[model samples]
Target: MKSNNTAKSFDYTGLKRVISLGLSQSKGLFIGVIFIAVFSACFSVYRPYLTGDVIDNYILNKDLVGLKLEIFKLIILLIFEGILAFFTVYLANVVAQRVIKELRVRLYNHLIKFKLGYFDRTPNGVLVTRSVSDVETIAEVFNDGILVLLGDALKIIFIVAMMYYMNWVLATIVIVILPLMMIITRYFQKALKDVYQEERTLVSKLNTFIQERLTGMNIIQVFNRQQAEYSKFSSINNDLKKNYLKTVLYFSLLFPVVDIVSALATGSLIWFGGLRTAAAGDVTVGNLIAFTQFITMLTAPMRAIAERFNSIQRGLVGADRVFDILDANETLPNNGKKKLEKVKGKIDFENVEFSYVPNNKVLKGISFSSQPGETIAIVGATGAGKSTIINLLSRFYDIDSGSIKIDGIDIYDMDLVNLRHHVAVVLQDVFLFNTTIFDNIILGDKSITLEQVQEAAKVIGIHDFISSLPNGYYSEVSERGSTLSVGQRQLISFLRAYIYNPEILVLDEATSSIDSNSEELIQLATTKLTEGRTSIVIAHRLATIQNADQIIVMDNGMIVEKGTHESLLAKNGYYANLYEVQFSKMNS
Candidate 1:
């Protein structure tokens, strides 16, 4: 998760690669569009020709029969043109929709597979903007810009050629202004593109600010910081407004300049053609009229080029943002060939060193081991690296140095999914999806039967609690489980971990949130659950781990004391001091 500035500067080659990938998925529709566009361009040539005929053989000569024939041909040509235009628009839209669908799915899938560290740094709103806004912009580019650009370029060429064939003098006068028009358009395009890029970037930032404040509105209100938040939002909003105004101003300046240039070109054609006609030249009144129409047609396509180029620049900027996510390195790679069929639950950490930041160690030279079916209690103050150990065991982040092994093979040598499959974690901060209670319980093992879910819930002493609900196991949990009490969420999370029945379990203050009554039941259930599994418990209450097979007391990322409860008590060291403080607090 780089800053927005860094993201903006991300290499566009990757974006082009992704665009190429998207187009490859719809080669058939693209080819069809190309074919229809050419056909449409061919039909466009007939308009100027018919107008010339009506002038030379009918208007000047007063041949009513010739006029009727020319008018009939014009009607037939219009009918064909209408059909080609409809299909070209239809096929282009179809292709655009398909490309957008595939691109969105690919981006979402890539996002889900990214490592935990990636999410830790990226804001939800930034990711959402890339997935939604960026994809939509690219789709618009495909539907309007690419399709029209192809057809219009062809149309311009054909129109110019027909005008020249009808009468080269009028054609030359009309075409001479094109070079000047092009130069002005190019300048406008570059300026507009720069402004549009700024506009899009500011929009993403505004979205991020709004999303963050809205999601944390509760915190803002509780802290009585509404005015502060409003001020912050206003700052970002003002930035967005400035960029938007600049973009609009550039577009405003562009259209008028183009219109004036086009009007001049048309007036020049009419004036010069009239002179040639009066000189007894081949030009007729109908030819001059058709020439004006052809020049008008040129205005649309030329202006279209300007509009299309602007849209393309905006889309490219968005694509760059999207490709940044797609190209992110997965810090945790799944390169392991071996799968643990049945782990012995034996774990070892030998001379392990780790740090999220370089050269600043969080855990240093740590060595420890747990036997099969053994309970290891880790007790430490806050920021003592208790969570870091669990993170390493789960391989959420790789170690900077040394090794962590399960059984005999290094954990890194085991398939990441399989390694995690053998381990289950119940954390203090539980997360439940907006789904039924039964579904949440079975989330750890989707294949578990209803009976299995019930059995695990009963063992964890939450079956009756869930049964008491209005919908029982079918009850829907609101977002973040706002409908349930904190203790209830904890109970449900414990049941989820028990249903998995992994060989290794880690509980990080899992019971700290529950009331005393619920804690007793959870303790009882945890005792039963760890009977034949390796368990690591991190708790603030020393009484909870009195029966643990062994206790390792940590301080500053190092094990200061290790022994059974009775042995550590007799040693009168860090463990004795910790137990005495807790026991004194309870008695008071």
Candidate 2:
């Protein structure tokens, strides 16, 4: 969650992690890129040196045969260098692409295992940015940042060696400018890195804002706040523009200064090298010409050094964000070794206590039990801990002090996957993927065939509805099934749960928001669903649970009344008052 973009020192540890991820699956490609780069550097520097060789040894002697042979050798050298350059870029890109793919996979795999609470606190856009754009930035580190910098450095070293070998005095003149160039380059690198970090942070915030605003655009329109939202977006857009301009300004300034310094070095090389040639016949014209070429070659890498550092810092910033999620370790513990092949669906909550936050209990010493093949109805007003019971039963959140058991075995001792497999929950708001109705129902479970889906839909009394669609079972559902009516979507949810054939069924306000006709259909489906399974129904509507074997009335996280519908009404207590009030409202 924290970004280290503006840190004064380089993050060598993060760089190591990025390198490790790149090399994890593509070590051969990475090694090949490095090897190609080394050979390419040698060819690049040697070409300039060879030109000097041609000028001094062959061309100066007026030997046509020697000049032609040297020209042929120069041509061959250029060809080999071109080939090496091509492979260097190609292999580095391959390594980068492979690393990015591996990084995305690792990030996604880590995110899927994180507990619900982690998601509750994190923005959807932040995670999306990290997984996508931020991970993509890391590719530059391999292709254009680290490897390119390495090759350029190697080339500079070879050019310096050649200069020193040909004429030490001229080499010293060129070398004196380097220390100053490095000092300036280092300063710009640090400055650019800090600004880039701030820029990246702003980008994340901007993405988060855009994602949230788009998701809630309907609310903005309904509330007549379009202009207000637009203004907010404009402000963020302006800030991003300013940040980008700052980057451009720094780059514009840095490159010109580098060019100016390179020009100074070239001037000094010509002035000093010319003097020695004119005075004592010490320095050759070929050596002076070659030194100029070496200076030009050295300037390229020198200028690129700061730019490459910027790229590396950008990648490091991205790597930090990605590794933040990868190292979160917020996943649920699946230490339980017990896997039940078949669960009998006996559920019990004994003296349960739970709180999403400390000292703010959502469930207070709650005790409940449902025998196999019995439907237990839980009734409560908003925030009375009704849905919390279902969540606890599903082990979505661990209890602070209690034991939740299925078939008299503690749920903690049961494999999380197996426990969820045997338990099915149908929420009031059903979520369907933007996919075919059949695919949504099967959910990639290869065992659930089209035939099985149709049969399940038929059993749930929704087959006729699906058959009426243009594409029948293959009809596409929009995002969150917005294209489907609430009733129709509910039916799809019912069919999905039914096909699973879970041992325990949880219907959490399943029919509370639908029309009477849809409710009636769902009522029939519910009856079929809870037939022989231990079922838990959380409802705000009293009439829906009148036939429930036992009705538990909850108030402020405690059960105040519990009995059959008749028994609770006869007692004329909390349940009776709730039932009377709901019926009066309906009749009114």
**Model 2: per-residue Cα lDDT over 1-588, one tens digit each:** 886545654678888888887788688888787888788888888887788888888878888999999899889998998898888888888888999999999899999888887888899988898999999988988888888788888888888887888778989999987898898888877777777777777888899999998878889999999999899989988998999998899889989998899999999988988988899888888888888888889999888878888888888888888888888989888877899999888888899999988899988999988889889999988999999998878778888998999999999998889889999999999999999999999899999899988887788788888999999999999988989889889988899999999999999999888865577778778988999999999999888898998899999999998899999999999989988999999999
Clashing residue pairs in all predictions, respectively, total 0, 0
Best candidate, lDDT-wise?
A: 2
Evaluate residue 420 in candidate 1 and report its C-alpha lDDT on the 0 to 100 scale: 92
Query: What lDDT would each prediction earn against the true structure?
Result: 0.82, 0.87
Error of 2 at 290 (Å): 0.8
Per-residue alpha-carbon lDDT of candidate 1 for residues 246-270, written as tens digits (9 for 90 to 100): 8788778888888998899988887
Clashing pairs in 2: none
- Model 2 clash number: 0
As for candidate 1, its clashing pairs are none
